[model samples]
Target: MSLSAAVRLRPGPVDLTSVETDAAPGFEGRKADGEAALAAMGAELAELQERLFAEGQSGGRRSVLLVLQGMDTSGKGGTLRHTVGLVDPQGVRITSFKAPTEEERAHDFLWRIERALPLPGILGVFDRSHYEDVLIARVRSLAPPEEIERRYTAINELEQRLVDGGTTVVKCMLHISAAEQKERLLARLDDPTKYWKFNPGDIDERTQWPRYREAYEVALERTHTEAAPWHVVPADKKWFRNLAIGTLLLEALRGLDPQWPAPDFDIDEQRGRLLDEAPIA
Candidate 1:
């Protein structure tokens, strides 16, 4: 299965309960092979990123935006470290959205997101994004039901504007099972090194798992679009998750097919001038 077919959420009604969180659909490789495959993709991703950067330097208006959303322990950070980490830092812009501060809360929800958008010829990654308003806000009752419903339309419009402005948005939900989440959380609590990742609030959120699932289902169904579709990545297997997302990203960049911009000045003349200049000691 292609990564696109394996995990990209379809339009219309979506039932989160039916999707397998642990399925590694497209990959039949062993663990070591999977790791090696991911490594090879890293090189490809680097080359494509360089082309994208060059295109931007030459005034190209294309860019990519990767939006990641999932429950805690779904490996959003891991995806960044292992998958997106392949790209040049100078060519990528990463943002992690947290709770709205006093100032942020004063404006519309998308105000902060608008400010963080990647420039042309860049790859932008959002650890959590505008969907938070629908997912967390709906589940936690942070906003009214009527307002939450409105945000669904609001998000679509915002993403459409991004697409219109030459941004190709790729959204992924790192789907993981409740059992896997329990094991991961326990491992975190048991390991001294991972204490910082263990949060009491996570437990609080876990208790509302069903509600959050419903929220996710609604958000995916409402917001998944041709312009900015969502991919439901099975993330219980960390290696597979990394491989799958890496593949998706590679596909997106390949689709763009950015080429290295040609030099506007005469290359031969420049080379001759360089050679004729005084040699360094």
Candidate 2:
């Protein structure tokens, strides 16, 4: 089945243009049956990733860029920890971008991200990427309105250029509701061991959920394009979110059809001789 058919994504009522400010229904925690579906999807994704890795080795060309952007506690780390665990690490790389360091801040925003792009025959995953410039900057009023708008346009063009240069871009926005986020935050606060996960600043951000929603809507609508479309995965149910993301990633990699490079010299005769002499040990 097509990825869309498998997930059965319902269109949000707010038009794409209005996604930033729109509060769509987030996926409730999965039902019991969702667990089985998630397992099946995980297996399928593993198989697909293996095939893509083999093809990537053969083709000796082509790479994939998977950009995962989400609000805090949207399961970005969990999804990466699980989904990527199924792939051959030698063929994949994950980069987590935090608040820029002094050196990173010295360069253009894309510079840090650009440096992390995948080489040929590999998959690169970006956790909280250049999109933060739009999402967080807008939320905190860090940049002027004119600058924010310009960055959005620049991001689209940059992604377009990457696609034109042979990097298939698969971007995902993990979607969760305010209530679910609250539950997660509270869970962290109530558990002594989980205290490290809670940030005092998170409380401040929670107050601005509505504004962040607006920021995301605008970001998604403006950034969504034919070359690099965004998949807004339902993240309230961690299992379903992972399943959907893994399914989408597997499909994208499968579509690439990477193949191993051809041998430079004939090996048939040498292989026959080696087989005949193999018992000489």
- What lDDT tens digits, residue by residue, belong to model 1 across residues 70-165? 999999999999999988999999999999999998998889999999999999999999889999999989989999989999999999999999
lDDT of each: 0.92, 0.76
What does candidate 2 score on TM?
A: 0.84
The global Cα lDDT (0 to 1) of model 2 is: 0.76
Query: Residue 201 in model 2: shift from native, Å?
Result: 0.5
Model 2 misplacement above 4 A: 1-32, 41-44, 54-59, 272-281
Query: RMSD for each model, in Å, please?
Result: 1.3, 4.0
Residue-wise lDDT of candidate 2 within 139-196, one digit each (tens)?
A: 9987788889999999999999888877889888888777788899999989998899
Which residue runs of candidate 1 sit more than 4 Å off their true CA positions? 278-281
Best by TM-score: 1
